[model samples]
Each structure stands twice: as structure tokens, then as C-alpha cells.
Target: MVALYGALFLSAFLAATILPVSSEVVLAGLIVAGRGDPGLLLMVATVGNTLGSVVNWVLGRGIDSLRNRRWFPVTPDRYEQASRIFRRFGEWTLLFAWLPVVGDAFTIAAGAARVNLGVFVALVAIGKAARYAVIVAGGLWAMA
Candidate 1:
């Protein structure tokens, strides 16, 4: 339903942020409950998750503004180190942006590293879409 997609979108968005939400749970619940078409659910989840990663990328771009804040989660040295790693490892690492824990960090680092925006969006979308595809396929397979 419309409300389900909205919840999935919000959950996916927050999951990609510093917050600890589980869009996956919402995704799986929808899948198992047979609420929406599988393809539609996959697309919605992918877009929502990708957009969340984009927020992290934008936040990465503003790291300097936040570095001095007492509430900043990352220390200055860690930021520098992550930047260095992203620089050395290359933007291909953006393919892992769908991962938990460090996935958001990768997006943030990509922003801090000033990765080409087109490349960032393309790679992030690919990774996130693939993840949703796998989840959808897995859930369907399990039910079958």
C-alpha cells in the first residue's frame, strides 16, 4: 500500500544515515506479507536506500564544518584516515556502500574525497539495487 512504501522509504532513508533503523526489516516484512508487488518493492527500497546514501555523501562534503563540533561522531584523525583510504582504494569502493556499519562511512568518505558526483551516484545505485534484488530474490525463494 501507499503507507507501506512511505514507511519503507523513511526506514531506508534513516538506515543510511547515522541513525539505527532497519529498512531491511520493513522490506522483508512487506515481502513476506505479500503486500506489494515484488518488483515495485525492490525498486522502492533501492531508491530509498540510494537516496539515504546520497545524504551521507552530502554530509561528507560538509565534514569540515562538523569536525569541530563536540557532537561530531567521527574524530578528525578517523576522517582523514577514511579519506586517505578512499583516495587510495578508488571509487570502486562505492560498490560496497550497501553494507552495514561501514557503508555510510564509505559514502561520507566518497563525498569528502570529492569523487565525481556522476560516478558516485552510478556506483551507489548499482550497489543498492543489487542488494535489493538479492533480498527480494531471497525472500521469494524462501517462501517458495
Candidate 2:
């Protein structure tokens, strides 16, 4: 059970970075296995996921001055778009951050765009927490 939680932590963290991975899928499996209480599992997964996102934000924050350097995968233009979306949507984007492919990119983009660290972390936490809650609820409902 703890291993599954740790996997979610590692997977979510790495996935938030440039690497391609799906912690959510693993979460689903763990839920099905009844490894942990659904609520607790969701909370752990969400926190792990959000922490991973912060890494990307920190990366972007570091690059605040130079924009996207040639070596980096992100570009200034993409960063601008992220900043605009974040400004318009504010914390809302975190809700959608759990989305399949887009979720990971959104996290990285948040950093590249240099969204506020505190707000960014909070939003990601909310978004991921919501996602896990929904998943657990649905899983329980289905089992019922």
C-alpha cells in the first residue's frame, strides 16, 4: 500500500517534469486494489502531483530573466501564452491539470510562464485533489 502511494508520488513528480508518465493511471489501479482509503490516497496523490508541478514552476522562475534559452524545450512565445492563460484563468487551470496529456504540459507551462509560486502550488493542489476525489468517488460508486 505504501509502495503504491510512493509510486504515485514518484510518478506524479516525474510526470510533471518534461518526462512523459501517468501517475493518475497508477492511481486508478491502486484504488481498484483497495490499497489505501480512497480519500487518503487521493490526498497523497494530489500533494505529490502538486509538488512535482512546483519543480517546473521553480524552473520557470529561474529562467525569468532570459526567457527560454536555446537549449530549453520551452520557448518565450509558449511562456507568454501560459502566462496569459494563467492570468485569465488564475487558479482554475489547476483543476484541469489532471487532464490526460494536457495536464502535465500545463504544469510545465505554468513554470515557463512564471506563474506565482504560492498561487501555482495552491492551484495545483486543488486541481489534483479534486481529480483524485472524483476518481475515488466514482470507483466507490461503481463498486457499490
lDDT of each: 0.82, 0.70
Residue runs of model 1 more than 4 Å from their true location after superposition: 68-81
Clashing pairs in 1: none
RMSD of 1: 1.9
Give the candidate number with the greatest lDDT: 1
Poorest 10 consecutive residues by lDDT, candidate 2: 66-75
Shift in Å, residue 102, candidate 1: 1.4
Off by over 4 Å in 2: 64-80, 100-115
Q: How would you encode candidate 2's per-residue C-alpha lDDT over 3-51 as one tens digit per residue?
A: 8678888887776666677777777777777777787778777887788
The positional error of residue 27 in candidate 1, measured at the CA in angstroms, is: 0.7
lDDT of 1: 0.82
Our model 2 lands, by Cα RMSD against the true structure, at: 3.1
